[model samples]
Target: MPIPAMTEQSDPLCLSEVTAAALLFDAPWRRFGVVGDSLSAGVGDPTPGYTNKGWADRVANVLQRVCPDVQYLNTSEFGVTTARTVAHQLDRMAEFGPDLLHLPCGPNDILRRKPDFDEIEKTMRRMYDLAARTRALLTTFTLGRAYVVPTFPDWDERIRAMNAITRRLGAEYEAVVVDMWNHPVNDRDNLLSEDRIHFSTSGQAVMATEVVRQLVYMLSSRTSE
Candidate 1:
């Protein structure tokens, strides 16, 4: 049986989705790198079967299908901003020397009070440039809907604005941007974890499937290059 491409428009994921993703996880990850924060840590999502497979983990599972030799080092922490991620990413690059990297951040920054957007941009540029120096390929993920409290006014707008800078940079630097904004899964009942900040087990699987779909496109485009 073929695993359907899951899309949730306020609909919860079914058992079949999880089964399909596990099959996809059979892919290899002998190469790759991951740079992100808590969300990237898979905090809001549950592990597959036994352990929780955060977005990065799920992304790795997907890439393995295409790049059997792919390997990744997830440096994303539970609570990290762009500035914090930038501070440590270069070090990871120096240590791991991976060919692929994933970046997910900014929700926490925006959720905080008086976060220095200027500093965030400065750090972000450094992170971007660092990828080039390390000869590493960078892929970034953006937030769809924040479940955290005191939701920022125009949350979507702010996320898009930040992503705009990322998008422009992606074009200039030739990076991949996976936009999960407006994804139906973000709003599904029990789609996210109890805290409402992360995705539940089913939610993780749903997100993982989407990321894999994008990764397929990304890998296809890269190989043609």
Candidate 2:
């Protein structure tokens, strides 16, 4: 099926709506830490009508509104792979002692000419193992279908493999997985930035909204339980 034309008015969710959704969660998280690649860094190009802030920052801002004392530490860097993230970012995150943590899903791991899924899984498991020791509410997002690498003809397959690994690890660690594989936002024509890789600010807004909603669901489920 073809995606419909997208316009400024066609954005699925606005920043105000993201804030509103976040306000619904009476979350207990006062410390948030994020680590991994550019995705974890919330890298994106600015859209005409959307805020340039990445999803992580937007989420952090919302959390700050809910808990004024909330401390956010994002040790993510652009162009870093999963293994490098484990090496460089994990210690800082552990030291920060976050009550809420966001881990990477290894988008860069599969960007290589011949990605070693076995090594990727091993490294990811190690990363998660260390992260779980922090006893934080872990969170991550699967890659959106809109994210692509024209150079890699098998990009879609690589993404599927990567997302599967993410889902599996996320489940093992009891992490909140904001599955974005086939999200409606992926249908937008303006989803990607000029790099044709990273999401645009519009996509970032939608991502932040979804993350808030998922966190609310987790909180709500705990309350009911």
Candidate 3:
């Protein structure tokens, strides 16, 4: 049977509902792997773990409730740049062989005076390749202007530039782009931590919700196919 091409009138809710049911009814074993910087590591949202349990861990917990055999491995390092992430993290991520992968970095790279976008794009493409090799669904996110590091006067332009790169690379690599640049939650002050850089516990919950929805949609759609 041939798969039908999606039409503009297709109802996304229909697909999502179907997928959610499949997760509940026909649960499959899965593994979720993560790479990139602090956000992926769940920096501000402290949970009871040797490593701080962030959104990725939260995501894993949700999946486990549905599919008890779900495994998770996170290799995110705080302040790791995109290039270094590709160099150091991708190998470990591939070795873990995750069913889905999340990479959300760029703040560390863009916080500098000069950001090499071409290099960043190159690194993103390479990481996407690694995801393909491991057969993991790649998900990436854009940063919003909720917080600014101290003395980084031009933080606005830097975030915009980094988000642009994230959008571009995400599209190019066929990864799910969590559009935080336009997410309504970013407008609230309560979502950020004291450092003005990381998300508060509530914020990480929101982030985890977004990721879980995406995973459900993705996995359910695959099952439907």
Largest lDDT belongs to which candidate? 2
Enumerate clash totals for all models, in the order shown. Answer: 16, 0, 1
**Model 1 lDDT tens row, 1-225:** 997544433234432334434544543335677776776776764533423556567666556554556666777777787777778666865588776666664666776655566666667777788777767666776666645454566666567666666666667677767666767766666666767677776666666666666555665666699
* TM-score of every candidate: 0.75, 0.93, 0.79
Residue 29's C-alpha lDDT in candidate 3? 40
Worst ten in a row by lDDT for model 2: 6-15
Rank the candidate models, highest lDDT first: 2, 3, 1
Candidate 2 structure quality by residue, lDDT tens digits, 6-108? 5434655654644544555578999999999999888988887676889999888888887778999999999999889999999999999999999999998
- Order the numbered candidates by TM-score, best leading: 2, 3, 1
Who is ahead in lDDT, 2 or 3? 2
lDDT per model vs. reference? 0.64, 0.88, 0.70
- lDDT string for model 3 (15-130, tens) is 23234434545445488888899977877844221123466776777667667788988899988987788899888887787877888657888766677777776776776777
Pairs with backbone N, CA or C atoms under 3 Å apart (clashes), candidate 3 = 42-54
Candidate 1 structure lDDT: 0.64
